[model samples]
Target: MHLGQLAQITIYPVKSSAGLNLTQTQIEPRGLRFDRRWMIVAAATGHFLSARETPQLLQLLVQPSEQGLHLQAPGLDLQVATPAPDGQRQVSVWDDELSARLADSETNNRLSDWLGQAVQLVYMAPENQRAIDPRYATAAAQSVSFADGYPILLLSAASLSELNRRLLEKGRGALSMARFRPNLVVDTALAAHAEDAWKRIQIGAAEFAVVKPCVRCVLTTIDPDTLQREPDNEPLKTLIEYRRSPKGVTFGMNLIPLNQAELALGMSVVRLA
Candidate 1:
């Protein structure tokens, strides 16, 4: 049955950097094409950097280019070519350690200057198979990109509207969906937090398994436009009052694609199981 319509598609080509909104995209095994395929890592420790600790990352604008990426910040505008496979480096994304290809030294230097730290841009080459956490994997050998956990994150507009309604009642301003960084947003008549019960769904020509409810973090309290922490942490503080679970306060649902296909805005969403 029709449950909703796809409202938005967003892809973060580089983890932690700004996301690029799209009207349509192809879904691959890992995720939407170019989604979180590139990441910034500490040069010394080889650990991933995210807006949770480095709010400055939210200010970096990244656009996917034919050759690689076009990155821009207040004083920096640079074109980074797709890294060749030869420069191998071990990078850690949370608990997952994998081999990734490092971008050229010039690109690394420019980014480091922009962030005022020693950092390198790394790419997950096709051969670097980072497995999805087995505890949550529905299919054997499922792989994912550099995303925080799952391949795709889905949220309903109705859910955000409900959150905003509560925020307004509390004398707080509304927030945009960008704060949550979801790959998909569905406009539906479902009640607030209804997606938490979804087990399987189909959008456009692709099917997906709703794997888990997304656990929100301090990253949600940062303003994407100003790159500053909210003085009151309104949304998160409010969410914790009502949305807390054993895992943490939750906001969205994580998804794993079941097949290769294309997804577009306005596509009907069907609950399968």
Candidate 2:
């Protein structure tokens, strides 16, 4: 397995929604340019929202426009401007809250009904004030799409296989890679910390440096199909016992591409000393 060859490339234009697969994708400092750049919000409270709290957001399908953004679900299709209005409102992600824009009335109504709730849309704007967590200072205060806080999440296929082996031993059903929601999935011949070696690796025409190990979260416990939090927490517990980091048990490496290059699935990835 090679690092450069993309085993899979998926994007959630709308946070918590289904991912779109692409044979080739652009790599930007803050992850794919249009990635989680836009998010649906709560119209009444002017708060930024996500599938983390309401997993139903996963059902919304987003259609990318040259400028406008459109989302459609069960029976609703809503279209709005790319950069939301100028007026700012306080928006929160987990514990961090920041200034963001609330979508206009028309768009909000459309999305709310589709979601079977009252909600609006919000877009993260370019700003210089944001900063990364102290532990990930190496990532800097770069602008990020709607992705939690990190730019990208990378996972190794072999790592998942190893975990599945353990699951089988415990008589647990096998899990799919989608459960991890990785932007870059590498197939590493090496053992643990295989991604750590990505510090300087070439895949196809692209080169990258591992920025930091991604900390696992409760989101991992949420099953995409059922959209319900798992009870056993077997994988997470197993990871903690085997893959705990100073922050926590980390399964993937968040990476930033060092050089721009055309990348495609099945391309060759080489580790550089």
The numbered model that scores best in TM-score is: 1
**Per-model CA lDDT versus the true structure:** 0.93, 0.71
Residue 201 of model 1 has an lDDT of 97
- Report the lDDT tens digits of candidate 2 across residue range 169-246: 888888888888887777657674577656666778777666688888877777888889879885797778788878
Candidate 1 regions off by >4 Å? none
For model 1, state the Cα shift of residue 232 in Å.
Answer: 1.6
Estimate candidate 1's alpha-carbon lDDT, on a 0 to 1 scale: 0.93
Give the root-mean-square deviation of each candidate in angstroms.
0.9, 2.9
- Tally clashes: model 1: 0
Candidate 2 ranges with C-alpha deviation above 4 Å: 1-4, 44-47, 84-88, 94-98, 125-129, 134-141, 259-261
Relative to the true structure, candidate 2 reaches a TM of 0.84
Per-residue lDDT tens digits for candidate 1, residues 1-21, read 789999999999989888889
